[model samples]
Target chain A: MKALDSFNPLAVFVYFMASAGIAMFSMDPVILLLSMLGAVTLFVIRREGRQTGTHLFSLFLFLTLTVINPLFQHNGRTVLFVLNDNPITLEALLYGADAAAMVVSVLYWFRSFSSIITSDKLLYLFGLLSPKPALMISMALRFVPLFRMQAKRTDMAQRALGKYKEDNAIDFIRMKLSVFSIMVSWALENGIITADSMAARGYGTGRRTCFSPYKFRPQDALLLGLSLMLAGAVGAAMALGGLEFAFYPTVSKISPDFLRLAAYIAYALLSFLPATIEIGDALKWQYLRSRI
Target chain B: MKPIRNEKLRRTVRYLVPFVLAPGFVALGITVFHEKRYAFISLCIAVSAVALFATGFDKKRTGSRRLVIVSVLTALSIVGRFIPIFKPVTALTVLTGMYLGAESGFLAGSLTAVLSNFYFGQGPWTPFQMLSWGLLGFLAGILAEPLKRSRVLLFIYGIIAGALYSFIMDVWTVVWYNGDFSIKLYLAALVSAIPYTVSYVVSNVVFLWVFAKPFGEKLTRMHIKYGI
Candidate 1:
């Protein structure tokens, strides 16, 4: 069962750029809420529930941001309460929540983004522009896990050599520093070897050829076209002031006009596109299994 | 025929691009424009341009060796973030700057923030982290000779780098809280972040004191050997 994530790297990249770009840039609460809902739906569909607990920090951040805004900003006319001679306004609180939603939704979108676009896909995208930075990124990504493994091995070797017998804090710090230095020296040595190998292979001598497994299929084109169209529609609406809402001074009345409604629908559709694709694939799989 | 002039151009660009041009665009975006979106886009563009230019410059001179070294250093910085309290990222970034040229150091610092954010979660703060660390690395490179000569200077720079990082991040905080930048709000934000800023300073100084010598020695050896 191929999911939307298995599409061409360009398609995934475009989809995320559009969705996350909108999620980060749009300030309207309704648009932000829809984006958040869509992002959460995708996370659920992807069965990333276990990772949700780790995001509690972001939730804390959202809450803190939301609470802190009304304290510092007293721009609205309708004062909700007075705390320590400072007025807390409804507009300020609402604005805080909206801003917090923007941050949190963008975070969630990026969470799914990183999962969907692996390092190879990222490199492929970057490689199109310049192969040098792309190569650097790929190497850096590779070295992260490699260095972690080396650090662990160094630690284990040090422990085996009875270096961990020191029960004092200073000695523990000294031991850790020594291990880190060993790791740094080892990494430097390995890097030279890699550089030599790359040179021997004539890495910078000619135009680079990209050997990616991803292929742009008809469906990928269709999906990309649809995403662009949806994004374009949303952008047009925003340009036309259909999604405009002022939070400071006073919360502006949200006029439920037809164009605004259509824009909201388009944005919701765009944001939820990944979840829809995943669910549709799951349903089709289940239906085929049942028929069999 | 124009080789000497070209060398002068390269030398000027090596200093001017990251320190002047990049921060200039970012400042223009934030101060000249009222739109937060444009400001953010400008910041991103500036950071990316600086990173790409630095790496490109390094690649032209040292080829892939500098790239590999920067990547490895960035990886180490990322891994250093996993250490619970006292993060060694600033120390390592500074060391890389002191050993590898400023361009490699800037690339390593910026790349570390961006790459580590993949695991820590990305937000608007990611670019700020990149810019702050990148600038710190750039400064370290400019001061590399003196820094390498004196441990005291290195530790002082580490403290300054930590403070500078916190200060820049607090600007982002103030802007996020209030839709626009205000000096009063920024001051308040700084005051509020005093405790965290102190911790950052302490950790940076402590880590630099501990890790600089060993890492600097190895990196110096590698730099001489590989000419990277």
Candidate 2:
């Protein structure tokens, strides 16, 4: 699992996209539960020994989503209670629970995703597909810190010139706006200089190619293949109505058969692959250390 | 005659994406997927639309100076998102559109969402945010003459931009919740989202009112001085 981050950027990107896509699209209770467990486990493993508020926040969101749905959505067979001429249905409650689970699961997956796929990896991916946008993104990213520093400098200079007044909300806004305006001018001026220098250095005179340290290794190939296979199976099963569930007028029972069970297992394995890899790697490390 | 026929075919294909393919996706999502896959379908639509717009921008012969200026504005708007209760991203994007051009505006708006999400956590909502803000800038560019002509018109456009942004986001909310688009559920979501929308509108109006002249004058000055 530690090596997961070191794999080819495409593999990691595809794996996360597949997992998150399934998490969002599928409403099956079993699939959602698996996704939540997988996501939380990966998140906890990655952020070990830290005080994580993610679980708590996810819990709060889950409760709020679950409770809020019954208020607005009143279509169901079993009536739970009535508040103001609106009957809260058991179906709506269940639907809300599933929806909440799906959301929380997706949230955790993305949390782990952000930690794994850093800007460099994303840039590599972008550079592979489109060079110009990738260049623009890198340029924009570089400018962010430069602009921040310039904004600070501009603010200090203004203060030094006896223009610092934040006596009220309006005044505070004025101060910020003035600083931002000045920074924009500074940035644009500097940008033109940079562009002129770039042209002088013959930036656009040749085909652009960026250096990337990541190479497609055999392990990356294996990971990519496995993720694609699993995602494809799940997606195909879904398209064929193998894992369909109705939650509207009435909640449908899950009848587990061959294709349905296969899809569910495939999704579970796909989501848990990272956590499983982590555990395996840790166990191997501990065994080697004890032997030594 | 043959070349003219090919040109006519090319034009039809160019218009096909937005005119035919977009609505086709919606119809297919509703009829075939039975609306259970609407969220994914709508996400695909948003992603492709953004891709189309981006490719269009890339095809234009944008100078390195213009690119760098766009990057700078993108960075500023991204940093502006950290401010509490009010963000100048939209106002700045509109100003960029009005001064620099519509394509620059769109690029800045979309790039702000994508790059800032590095800190804010990327999710399915990123595409929707990019589309909403990008369109706001694009339209601002289209209406730049009139908007720049009058303060009242600019403020009105600001309000509309804010409302339009929030309402487009609500489409995501409704799709995520119900797994499809339902008018009743959409209305419910809109009602619940009123407070956020109102604040969005207020902040946009305030940002534009305060920052418009300074930013505009500087941008216009740079356009003449630096020729970017």
Best by lDDT: 2
Candidate 1, DockQ score (0 to 1): 0.34
lDDT of 2 by residue, A71-129 (tens): 87899999988989999999999998998998889988888888788888888876765
> What lDDT score goes with residue A91 in model 1?
91
**Tens-digit lDDT string for candidate 2 (B18-113):** 888788877655543443568978887998788767767756678999988888888888888888878888998998888889988888898899
Pairs that collide in candidate 1 are none
lDDT of 1 by residue, B66-163 (tens): 77888888888888898877788888889888888777777788878877887776666777788789888878988999999999898889889989
C-alpha lDDT of candidate 2 relative to the true structure: 0.83
- Model 1 in CAPRI terms: which quality? acceptable
User: Ten residues in a row with the worst lDDT in model 1 chain B?
Assistant: B1-10
lDDT of 1 by residue, A159-190 (tens): 88986667888878778878877888899899
Candidate 2: residue B94 Cα off by (Å): 0.7
